[model samples]
Target: MKKNLFVFLLFSCFLTHSQTIRKYSNEFMNIGVDAAAMGMSNAAVANTNDVNACYWNPAGLIGLEDSQAALMHASYFANIAQYDYVAFAKPIDDESAWGMSLIRFGVDDILNTTQLIDANGTIDYNRISKFSTADYGMTFSYARKLKLPGFQYGVNTKVIRRIIGNFASSWGFGFDVGFQFEKNDWHFGLMLRDITTTYNVWNINEDEFNSIKGAVAGQNQDLPQSTEITLPKAQLGLSKKFEFHNETSLLASGNLNMQFSKTNDIFATDVVSIDPALGFEYGYTDLVFLRAGVGNFQTVTQIDNSKKIGFQPNIGLGFKYRGIQVDYALTDLGNQSAALYSNIFSLKVDLSIFR
Candidate 1:
């Protein structure tokens, strides 16, 4: 019992310290959606020109040749988490388009360890409860080409909701704006996420606090809290396509992401966070694709009193026939073990097929 108590104290301390590095709520909105984007290290903002563009850069939606729909699913953290995404886009005319997208991320069958006790005055393993936590978002977007010909701009209005079983929940609203310029074989894109600094209002009622107070007796407890602000973020992308032979081309893309807001979480002392990623896709006659990327760089303290940047790699394969596209991607989780990776699959349908 003493050993267990000691371990619990240590874990509590770690949690307190880790908050410094963590950011505000609805982080799932930042996770990349489609397999092609993840397979390419999320560097497709400038190069995305399909239905999925609504999730990346809405400006890219103007490039969709027809009404399109895309669906994506992935298992993260060894299947402990599930992510699903869907998007639809329809070009209104020659120079304008509108779209909508839905995103869902969840963890199911989580053991509610706080209620593990039984009335017999002893721990009852079977008495432990299970619950699921889910995050969801819906976005509507509009994009139009500029009179400048190669330049385009877009905006997205987002509604976000998060739920933790029947205990607590939050509602948030935000907006995104993006610009894209495409000429010849080169593309440039910029996106401002949560441009208005999304605000999430959490409602933690008395009943919710009472439900867990018994298990959290001491250890620096605080009253139920409400409200958190998500800071704005920026992303810049540049991509170029090099055509070699009969419709075969190689596309190289790079992205730079930065956070401008400060977090109460103390994980890092820096006022801003910057991450860069690079990706490449080789397309064969626009039928098959081979993709790879490297990014997720972070400085880590080494055992030898040295600091080094860590890199995570990703690879993906894709096939497109007629109006149907299938894509698969595997992202390295930096664990070195092959089994410890993110698996993603995506399917896209071009509604023009019906025409």
Candidate 2:
């Protein structure tokens, strides 16, 4: 029985699937971060003239005007979960730059109900256990201009870690590559995420599993531990900038994101899914900004010639001054019972000011 319980606990992590067809792992990495990027519907792959370029497109790292530092935080589902990010970038020379960033996503205060009863078989709420789940990643990036003018390329190597309470943990490694081109008022970008196929191997502590087994005796099952892999994805973006006479400008951007993994899961009438996103931004002399975006367009076809679509929208505002920038955004989660919205805030500073 104890052995069975251990097995069940080991395999339970794979059961948290959102849809019937589970083709991918590490879904949390898909949740967009950074207020400016999320406010722009995560379509900033080509609009990388900011610090968050490290996340959207490492190739954009060379686009930074000077040394910069940024921080972002978000409360998901009204504080049920949280996401945070920090980044720093410095130009290596006239045509190259280096950057580093850290991201953390987590859910806390989860009650452990496996040990609900005491040895006497009496219901004891005091014996209930609680734990937290955390996901972390550290990314190192480098960007340099290509021999062809107006063209730049970059790469990012990242280390990933996941923790579920204290029972199970996993470590992973992956790489990303990207390119950007800019000329006149037109910008284009392409990114290949997990180009090397991120892999995570989970380690289940025997002592912890034994403790859980003892708590739930006679209810154990055998389970096997294994490694998980995340397939590669591609993203393409385009943007145009329009300048006005009053130091005001408008930027329009759009992205085509696709997953090319070999999977049997059908979405929107196909085995592969192509998601599109659109966004608009208005800026006044790089001081104040307003942005709006729409994304998550999915269509489900019913048997009787009917269809349903999922579309989520978002909005954001921000201000920038000498060496300082702040941004805020509101994201719609689309019909989730726990919460319907999320709030994100970001702050950035130019470290060059101190140098």
Candidate 3:
């Protein structure tokens, strides 16, 4: 009990410290969807299966008996449509596995805009513009079971691209390394993602920064507009499974994730926060499951200072039949009602090629 309390306190401190480094950017690009099933459960990380291990904890592949593949898609915010993921994993002999994954988020039908000028030498109202934001990544991963007692490891490399209308675009690369340990039904996992200082090289084509005619004489000089933006994330989690009966089990887990970056842009300052979460899953005969979870950062990290803590909550449900699974999740961002509610739904088919 004392050890558990100590771990909890340590995790809390880490969350507190994480806030100082929070920033927001092309956040949609970095969002990860390991499996539709897990999405319904609020993106829990510590408890995962072989198919999703590639994204959440590669060490999970060590427990699989054969090769498997999965695909998932989500509709975000109802307006920013089209988010999807696909992944596959196959064993290397008996102690290792190799995997591949892809993620994409895109939007369409944005109103294009252009600047307008009046005859009086003054700028008129800006024209309504349509634009799009899209980002995608491809990842290669490998995981191996260690001969040492209770240890497993995995690593992943990803190439990323971000497109913002016709005026700007960027590309970058990042990596993730992870470790997991299991003894009996208890599990521990850690993942350090975007560990390398990754940056996107932006090529800007518009003269949006041009100074006005009356601007300071020396300040009007055109400046170099190209820049790079960086992203970094770290996560640690633990879980334990409890057997309630011959055909039923319950899983409870906790997670802490921290992100660091000099700026939200390839070059600007951003907000930071430490998000803590708790989740549970109940299963019967390994065929059907139900799950729910809640998570929130400290009140100081919230975007709106007027809101109180304990407002955001997440819920999800999933079902499986033979090799097919379907999942759905809903997230509530308290008091931020103007923003569309966050929801995700996914369907996956798992194929076992060898057995």
Q: Please identify which of the two predictions, 1 or 3, would achieve the higher TM-score against the true structure.
A: 1
Which residue pairs collide in model 2, if any?
4-220, 4-221, 4-222, 5-220, 5-221, 7-222, 7-223
lDDT of 3 by residue, 110-164 (tens): 5432333344646554643456667778788888888888888888887877665
- Sorted by TM-score, highest first, which candidate order results? 2, 1, 3
Whole-model lDDT per candidate: 0.80, 0.79, 0.62
In angstroms, the error of model 3 at 18 is 23
Q: Lowest summed lDDT over 10 consecutive residues: which window, candidate 1?
A: 13-22
C-alpha TM-score for every candidate = 0.87, 0.87, 0.75
Q: Give the Cα RMSD of candidate 2.
A: 4.2
Worst 10 residues of 3 by lDDT: 13-22
Q: lDDT for model 2, please.
A: 0.79
Off by over 4 Å in 3: 1-22, 34-43, 115-131, 206-225, 260-273, 300-307, 333-340, 353-355
- Model 2 backbone overlap count: 7
lDDT of 3 at 200: 52
lDDT of 2 at 131: 84
lDDT tens digits, residue span 161-268, model 2:
988888778888999999999888799999999998888877777677666666655644443345777888889999998999999999899988878843322243
